[model samples]
Target chain A: MLTVLVDGVASGMLLFVLACGLSVTLGLMNFVNLAHGAFGMAGGYLCVVLLNQHGVPFIPAVAAAALFAAALGFVLERTLYRQLYGRDHLDQVLFSIGLVFVMSAVVDWLMGARQQLITLPAWLQGRWDFGFMTVGVYRAFLIAVCGAIVLALHLGLVRTRFGARLRAAVDDAVVARGLGIPVTRIFGVTFALGSGLAGLGGALGVEVLGLDPTFPLKFMVYFLIVVAVGGANTIVGPFLAALLLGVVDVAGKYYVPQVGAFVIYTAMVVLLLVKPHGLLARGAAR
Target chain B: MSAALRFALQALFWGGWAGAYFALPEYLPLLAQIAIIALFVLSLDLLVGYAGFVTLGHAAFFGLGAYAAGILAQQGWGEPISGLLFGAAVAALVGLLTAPLVLRGGDLTGLMVTLGIAMMLFEAANRMAWLTGGADGLQGVEMWEIFGVWRFDLFGRTAFVYSLTVLFLLYLLARLIVSSPFGLALRGIKGNRRRMEALGTPVRARLVAVYTLSAAYAGIAGALLAQTTQFVSLDVLDFHRSADALLMLVLGGMGSLYGAMLGAIVFMVAHHALSELTPQFWQFWIGIALIALAIAGRGGMLGLAGRLLARWGGR
Candidate 1:
């Protein structure tokens, strides 16, 4: 049971890294961008190619993949996403889904439809035997990496000047604009940063989540679940939700493999029924 | 816009649709699929266009209907029309159960709820190997002749005619329902829910009714697909199914009945042509089209065609 919990926490942290970008874009920016996973897939492939083809170090490759994805996201935000801000939620959903399909097809053609693998360093790949519970070394590394990302995100959003401006923009774009904040530029930067985190998450998650051309389609609902259950706009809400969900999902598979993936979705629906606005509404937003 | 003009337009539209029977003999199977997909899109049009509800899991009902039909056939109840109706009834029941959750939230919440419900169903069907046949799909579904006279043929001639007839009947039923006062109330609710509520509408009940009805329509479409193919797969309930249906609705135009038909036809042709040209990468073009459609000033292909037609008329 303790082992399951440990594994779940590691899984949850990875999900948080992948889904936080969506949380901010959906909750803060009010944009239903389902293509968020596409960036994650991009980062995963980027890391794999860097590791396999170029013999780059694993840790630096992950960082490089994140930077590359962030650059790509910045270009998209400036060129394409700006046009979609004024549209309704329905349009946004369809638009992002379309973007996902396009990215999936393009990647499938470019990289072949097979799953991509990254060679982890020997130390990071070993299993650590700790008496009653033997945990995967990779999971421990994931938990650490993702925990640092979450901490940095929490502090950056709570304490920094840029985070304040972004929060103001999320609270009320028009009012924030009146207060002399560059709302569009802030939105663009935040969007790129979110995409970068998704890339980093993807690079870290090749072992746990698996890297594939259809990663977006396969994991789109999981990302959405984090956003929906977490209530968007806040890093902590999704962080907690992801942890809870990750535990539930991992435990479900560990204990009762019969019900399979249904348990997490059932839990999500019940949670949504109780709190339509989400677990943390205004406090996290503020 | 008037009753007479509406009648004439409907006649021309459906008449042309039926006229294709003798015109496109080589593509009967494809035409049958188009018929089923058009019905599916029509159901979505009611939920999305008339009721202003955005769903990402409409394929749940579609899969339910398909499975229901396939199971019935496997159990030796292979009658076509009855199988379709049974599938629809099951779907309506599921819709009734799930619509309350949908009504509680706004558009985004509703999307999440519907999607969650669909995913739950997908997982259920996937895990229940004994009942659903698991990844191998629900097979051994043996179908029978239509009305004991016209038998299903190797070339899909019977399938095309049967599906088209079903489509026409369902379209007529849908037209009557949409033209009723209840349909007007749905439109009013879509336009402004608060205003409709202020005027003494049982808003939740009406939404549930329409949602259930739409599910039934989708279910029948799924049943049709199952009967025509004699199999049911997990893909029937996939998010891709729902997304493609939505794409068809958007491409055709929303809020209009004929838009569903137009969207289905255009989407089918586009998918077929693009896949033929570059099978592995066709979705790229579809994605580009979706982005373009969303960024466009208005709605879909029908919307653009409407503007051009109006411009021509004014001239």
Candidate 2:
């Protein structure tokens, strides 16, 4: 039970890393960026290419991948996403769907539609034997890294003046513009930060879930479900929802094999039925 | 008389063009398939374009129809018309059952719910291999002749005529609906539900009705697909089917029934042509085309054509 819980939490942290970015982008921009998953996949493939093909170090490769994802996000925000602002949801959905196809095709063309394996470095190779349970050092690293990121994000949003201005702008963009905040720049920065986090999560997740071209399509639905159940505007909502979904998924797979595939979706349906506004209504509530 | 003659001439010109291509033996089957796809797109456009609902899982209705027809046909109900009705009935039933839950949610929430439902159906179909043929799909579906007069030929000749006739009839029905008071109500609902509610319109009920109606259309399209192809596959339920329907709707121009037909023709032709040229990287070209269309031709091919025509006339 403890093992399952630990594993669930670790998986949940990974989901949170992806869902949080989606939640913020959807809430603040109201832009349904289906290409977000593609960005993450791109990061994963880049990490693999750098490490396996170019013989780059693991840490530097991951960093480079994240930077590349961030830069792409910045460019997408300026070029495509800006035009989509205030458009109807249907337009956004169609445009994003088109973007998804474009990105997936590019990735498939480059990667040859085959699953690539990510090899962790020697320093992160060993396992920690807990007498009854053996856990990989890399899993521990993921949990620690994700925890640190959450902490950093919390501090960045609460303790910094930039965070304060961002919060103000999120509350009322027009009002913030009236008060002289650089709303456009803040939007770009926030998008880049979100994309970077997705890249980092993608890099880490490839080790756990292997890298595949269609990986984004398989996970995009779940990520959207997490974001929907967690509530869009609140940061912590995604964290809670991801953890809940992850645990349910792990447990369902173990206990009930027939209905296991539906566990997360069932949870989402139930949550939406109960709380239409989602679990968290405010960002600070986390 | 002159106005009527002009309208008839115009119709004949376009109809003859479609009929000429459809008369070719090799192209007839492809034309039938495109007609079914066009109908599917038109149904989706009614919801997404006119009603402002962004459903990513419209294939639920399409797949439901296909399975309904296949299952019924396998059970000795060999009549094609009855089979089509059965498919549409199943689709309408499912749509009605889920309408309440779907209508209550916001755009993104509704999208997720529909997607979840579709995925659930897909998983269920895969798991219940006995009933659904376990992913290999239900085959050997034989459609009975129309009133025992015309037999379904092996070369798809009968299927082409049957599908085209149904397509034309449905197109007329869709045109009637679009110009009817119900379509106006749907448009009003799309604009502002609160305002429609204030005006004493049963917004939720109207939405459910429209959704069910659209599902019926999708179901009929699916049934036509099975009837024409004489096989039913789980691919009908796949996400790609829904994505293709969405792309078709967007590429044609939403809210215009003719746009759906135009979009289907263009998309299928592009798909067929591109695949023939580069089998491995065909999807890459299609993807690039979609992005280019979305960016440059905001309103799609029909809209672009309209603009060019207007410009020429103005000049």
Candidate 3:
């Protein structure tokens, strides 16, 4: 039971990393960015390339992957997403779907469509034997790192000038503009931060999920399910949803092998039926 | 005399173009395939264009039709007409059953529901190996000769002519439906559902009808595919198939039947050419095309054509 709890928390942390970015972007921009998973895939592939091919160390490889993904996000926002900022939801969806195909194809072309294995370095490879339970060092490290990032993000959002400006802009862009805040730059910066977090998640998740060309397309639905079931704009909502989903998924797979893969979607449907505005009514409030 | 002569000349040119493709033995099968794809895209256009319903599960109907036809053939129902009828009937039944649940929600709700339904069908197809032949799919579907005259040979000579005729007939039917009062009601629903409902348009029932009609079209297309290919695979119900159909409809421009055809032609041509050139990177090229079109060409190929014609007329 303790092992399951630990495993569930680790999985939940990974989900939170993906869901938080989706929630932030969806909350502020009201743009359903389906292409977010592509960044994750790209980051994972980049980390694998850096570590396996270029002989880079682990930490630097992850950092480099995050930076690269952020840069791509920056370019994408400037070139394609800028035009779609205030467009209809259908156009945004189609454009992002197109981007998914393009990004996945590029990665598949370069990486040859095979799943790449990512192994942790020696320092992170061992297991810690607790008196009650033995835990993977890597998994424990991932949980710790993700938790720290979440704490840092919470602090940054609640207790910083940038966070204040972001809140103001998200509340009303026109009002922020009236107050002489650089709303456009803030939007770009926020998008980059969200995308960077997704990259980090992808890089770390490689050890757990492996790297494949179709990974983004397959895993994206689950992330969106989380974002949709949780309140899109609320930070704590995703955290709650992620933990709930992670536990359900792990427990379902262990307990009911046949229907395990479908538990998340079923849960999402039930949640939506009961509360169409999500658990916290983000869509309704918006 | 001069006006009559010009009309005759133009008629001759277009008639020759259409006739050459239809009559040629080798080109018949290709033409037929194009027609089937055009019908598939047209079905999508009705939802995306006329009804403003963005669905990613349209392939469920198509795949169901294919499996229906395949199962019937396996059970010794090899007659072509009955096979097509059976496929359409099964698809329409499924679509009608699912329409109420699908149409009650908002845009995002509808999308997720359809997606979930499609995934369920896909998983069921994989799991029920006895019924759907599992992942291997149902093969060896032998089609009977049309009216006891033309055998569907391996060369596809008969299949091509039959599919072309079916496509032309369906095109006319779709055009008529889109121009009818019911079609106007759909347009009204698309523009403003609340107002239409207040005006007593029975918006939900109308949407369900249109959804069923579109499913029937998809079913026919799928039956034709199974008949022509002599096999049915689980890939028919895949998400990518639905995505491709959506892409074709959008690329062609919504609410335009000819646009769907034009979009399919352009997309298929590009896919064939790009895949031949760089098979691994073809999706990237297609994606680039889609993004470029979305950014630059709002109305798609038809829109571009209209603009060019206007420019030339002005000159």
Candidate 4:
């Protein structure tokens, strides 16, 4: 039971890392970016190519993957995402879905449709026994890395000057702009940062989540669930939501093998019906 | 805009399909598929174009209908028309139950809830492999001849007529509904929910009614596909089908019944041609088309045609 909990927590942490970026974008910008997973996919592929084919070191490759996704995010935001900001939700959904399709097909073209495997370093392999409970080293590493990211993200959002501006902009874009905040620049940077975090999560999650051309589409719901259930416009909401989802999903899979993901999807719909704004609805916007 | 022109277009549309019977006999199967897809898209149009609910999980109803009809046929009820009704009835019942859940929130919430429900159904179908046939799809689904007269031949001649006839009947029903006072109320609600409510319209009731009706339409379309093809697969419930249906509706033009059919025909033909050459790469083109559609603005092919026609008429 403890082992399942640990595994669930670790996976949940990875989910938090993966879905936090989406929360910010959805909460702050109110942009329904279904294509967010494409960046994560790109990060996964980058790590695969760097570590296996190029023989880059593990830590550097992961860092490079995050940077690469950030840069890609920055470029796409300026060129493509900026135009759709004022549009309605339907347009945003369609455009982002289109982006997802294009990216998935491109990845499929470049990398064969087969799933790519990453070779974790020797230290990151195996498991460590802690008294009555045992945990995999890679999963522990994931927990540590993702935990640090969550802490850093929390502090950065609450304490930093940029975070203040971002919060203000999220609160009211027009008022923030009037207050001389570079709302557009903040959005671009925040978009890149959120995307960068997704990339980091992607690189780290490759072992657990699997990497493929369909990465974006397959995991799109997970990210959306995290953001939707966590409630937008807040960090703690998504973190807790992701953890709960991770636990529920992991436990559901382990116990009720027959039901599979039906449990999670059903829970999401019920939860949405009960709390349409999300579990943590403080300052939540449409 | 005139009645004569409208009647002529209608005649031409049916005349074209009737013409295809003799003209392109070998391509009847493809035409039948186009008709089925058009019906599906038309259902989506009722929800999206008319009711203003942007959903990504319309395939929930479509797949439900397919499985209901397919399973019924497999379990010794090989009758076609009843199979279609059973499919639609099952889908409509589910839709009625879920309408309240869907109507709870705004667009994003609706999208998520719909998607979640569809994913749940997909998982259920996948896990219940004993009944659904799992990944390999439900095989040995033997469909009976329509009305005990026209047997389904290899050439698909009977299938085309049956599907086309269903499409025409449904098209007329959809037309009547959209032109009715209830449809006008739906359009009003879509335009301004608050105002509609203030104007003494039962907004929720109307929405539920239309949503249920649309689900039934989708079920009929799915039943048609199952009966005509004599097989049902998990792909019927796939996310791609929902996305493709949305794309087809948008490509044809939203809120326009004729546009729905036109878009289906064009999209299916292009998909057939493109996928024939490179199966995977065709999706890239479809993506590009969606992006283009988003950037260019709404109304799709019919929208563009309307603009051009207006320009010519103004001169």
Candidate 5:
């Protein structure tokens, strides 16, 4: 029981990392980029190829994968995403979905339909056995890494100038532009950072979630759940939501193999009915 | 559309399809698939183009219709037309039951709810091996002769004509409904929800009505696919199915019934040709097409055709 809960916490942290970008983008910019998962898949593939084919170490490969995704994201932002900033939500959704299909197919051609796996370092590969309960060493490492990231992200967003600029740009682009905030550049950098974060999450999550060309379509619901059920644009909301969801989903699949993913989806529908904005969103009085 | 334009459109459509049937009998199966797809896209147009709802789980209704008809046919109630009607009713009932949840939220919430409903149903169909046939899908779905006369021959001629005729008739009904006052209200709501609400329009009720109507059409389309193909797979409820339908609608043009037809024909033909060459990589080309469509032409192929039609007609 303790192991299951601990495993859930680890999975939830990975989900938060993958989903935070989407929530912030959805809430702040009102842009529904469905292809967000495509970048994560790219990062996953990149990391796996690096580790498996090129014989690179794990941590360095993850860092490089994040950078590669961020660069790709920057280019896409300049050429494609900029054009879509003012389009309808429907157009954005459709356009991003198209990107997803294209990316999926591209990945399929590049890598066969087989799933990609990576080897963990010696220290992160074994289990840490306690007298009463045992947990995987990798799981403990993930919790520590993700916890530090969450703390850093929270502090950075609250204290840093770049974070303040990002928040301002998100809250009201026009007013922020009037205040000489370089809004467009801020948006570009922020979007790239978000993409990079998704990439990092993907690199880290390949073991837990499995890496495949269909990664985006398969795990899209989880990312969206974290964003929607947790409040969009808020840091802590998705964090807590991801933890709760990760626990519920893992436990549900374990206990009720018959129902599979149905229960989580039902919970989402009911939750949305009671609180349309999100579980943590302020009253929709505005 | 003007009466002259409308008449010309119908003549061109029927004439083109009928002529194509006689010319390329071998392509009947593909053309029939295209026609069913057109009906599906038309249903989406009623919601997205006219009613201002951008959904990601429109396949929920399509799958319901397919499963309903598939189950009916397997149980020996195999009359094709009645099966289609029953399937449509099932889809409409599902849509009616879920309409309130859809109506309660804005676009993001709407997207999530529809997606959630679809995923839940998908998982339900996947797990219930007793009813939905599990992952292998429902088998033994046989259909009776259409109106007790035209049997579905191996040549697929009856299937082609049946689907095209069904599509034509449904198009007429859709044209009538969209031109009606209720459709006018839907358009008004799409343009300005706040203003419509201020004008005392029953916004939510109208939305529910249109959504239900659209689901019925989608169910009929799904039923047509199952009846013509004699199979019902879980792929009917797939995310790709919904996404592909959305792509087809956009490729055609929104707010025009004929756009759905034109878009469906073009997209399906291209997809068929491309997938034949490189099944796995066709998405690369489609993605490029979508990107081009977004960057160069948001109105889509049909929208451009409409512009040409107006210019030529004026001349």
Candidate 6:
């Protein structure tokens, strides 16, 4: 049981790392970016390519993956996403879904529709045993790294000037703009940051989650669930939600193999019905 | 635009189908598929365009209808018309049950809830392989002749006739409903919920009624496909089904029934042609079209035509 809990926590940390950017973007910008997983897919594939083909080491490959996705996010935001900032949610959905399809097809073309393999370093391999329980070394590393990211992100959002500006913009974009805050620039930077985090998570998660052409479509729901259940904009909200989801998912699969993902999807529908604004949202219901 | 001219145009529009039945006998299967898709898109228009509920899990109803009909047929009750009605009823019942959950949330919440419900249904269907045949799909679905005559042929002549007739009847019904007091109230609710409620309209009731009706229409479409093909697959419940239906509705013009049909024809025809040419990359082109359409405008083909006509008239 303790081992399961640890595994769940590890998976949850990974999910938070993967989905926190999506939560922030959805909450702050009120944008429905369904294509966020495509960015993760991009990062996952980049990490795979860097490690397998280029013989690059794992850590630097993961960093490069984050940078590459961040740069892609930055460019896409300025050119394409900018045009869609104020569009209706339906439009945003259609546009983002379109991006997902395009990206999926592109990946399929480049990668031959096969799952990519990631080779971890020797130290990251094998399992560690304690007196009470045993845990995978890689999963422990994931928890440590992702917990650090969450802490850094929390501090970045709370302590930094940029974080304060972001919080204000999330509160009210119009008022923030009136106060001469570079709301647009903040959005761009945040979008890039979010995409970068997704990339980093994707690179890390490829080992556990598997990397393939359909990665975006397959995992889109989990990311959305994290964002929605976490309450849109807050960092910690998604963190908690992701942990709950990870635990529930791992436990569900382990306990009731026959039911599959029905439990999670049903829980999400029930949760959304009960708390549409999510558990942590502070504003009036939209 | 006069009543007589409208009548004439309508006759000509359907007349074109009859003409194609004789003229393009080889393409009857494709035509039948297009007709079914058009009906599906029309149902989506009722929800997205008329009622202003943007959903991404409409396939839940479609799949429910298909499975219900397919299982009934596979179980030895292969009567065609009743099977269609049964499928529609099952879908409508499910839609009615889920309507409150869908209406409880805002747009994003609605999207997620509906999607979640659909995914749950998909998972349930996948798990219940004994009944649903799992991923292999429900097989041996033998649809009987329509009204004791005119057996379904491999050439799809019967399928085309059955699908087109269903489409026409439903299209007419949809037109009647949209012009009714209930439909007007739905439009009002879509425009402003508070105002509609203040105007003494039971906004929730109207929405529920229309949503149920839309589900029934989608059910009918799914039933027609199942009956014609004599099979049902899990693809009937897939996300792509909902996404494609939404795309077709947008392509034709939201809230416009005729535009819905036209869009279905165009999209399916393009799909048929494109897939044959570049099967692997077909989705890429569709993605490009969707992005361009979203970026360009929401008016779709009919909107563009209307704009061009206005420009010419102004000139």
True contacts kept of each: 0.85, 0.32, 0.43, 0.65, 0.70, 0.67
Which regions of candidate 1 fall more than 4 Å away from where they truly are? A282-286, B1-12
lDDT of 4 by residue, B1-315 (tens): 568877998899899999989999989999999999999999999999999988889999999999999999999999999999999999999999999999888778899998998998999999999998998888888988888988999999998999999999999999999999998998998899899999999999999999999999999999899889989899998999998888888899998999999999999999888776665589898888888887777999989988887898789
Best by DockQ: 1
Which clashing pairs does model 1 show?
Answer: none
TM-score for candidate 3, residues paired by index: 0.91
Q: Write the per-residue lDDT of candidate 3 for residues B1-315, one digit (tens) a residue.
A: 257864786467336537856576665666667777877888888877888788878898889888899888877878988898899999899999889777764667667667767776777777677888878988778888888778898667777778767877888898899899999998998899899999999988899999999888899889988888888899988888887877787788777887887787677766755666776577787677667766774677777767776788688
Q: What's the candidate order when arranged by decreasing TM-score?
A: 4, 6, 5, 1, 2, 3
Candidate 3 clashes between residue pairs 3 or more apart in a chain or in different chains: none
lDDT at position B169, candidate 6: 91
Model 5 Cα lDDT, one tens digit per residue, B1-65: 58987799789888999998999899999989999999999999999889989889999999999
Clashes of 6: 0
- Residue-level lDDT of model 1, residues A33-72, one tens digit each, is 9999999988989999899999999989999989988988
Candidate 4 lDDT tens digits, A1-286: 8888888999899888888888878756888899999999988899999999999999999999999999999999999889899888788888888999998988888888998898899999999998898999998898899988889988998999988999999889999999999999998998999889899889998998899999999889899999988887678899998999999989998998889889889888988888888898964445
- Misplaced by over 4 Å in model 5 are B1-6, B311-315
- The candidate with the higher TM-score, 1 or 4, is 4
- Which pairs clash (backbone N, Cα, C closer than 3 Å) in model 6? none
DockQ, cand. 3: 0.53
Better of 3 and 6 by lDDT: 6
Q: Given candidate 5, what's the lDDT at residue B70? A: 91
| TM-score of candidate 2 against the unseen true structure | 0.94
Error of 4 at B274 (Å): 1.0
* Candidate 6 ranges beyond 4 A from true positions: B1-9
Lowest lDDT 10-residue stretch of candidate 1 chain B: B273-282
Write the residue-wise lDDT of candidate 1 on B1-315 in tens digits. 347876898788878767877887888888899999999999999999888888999999999999999899999989998999999999999999889988786678788899999999999999987888988899899998887778888788889888889888888898898899989999999899999999999999999999999999999999999999898999999988899999899989998888988899989977877766765567887788788888874467778877876788689
In the predicted model 5, the residue pairs found to clash are none
What is the lDDT for B291 in model 6? 80
Docking class of 5: medium
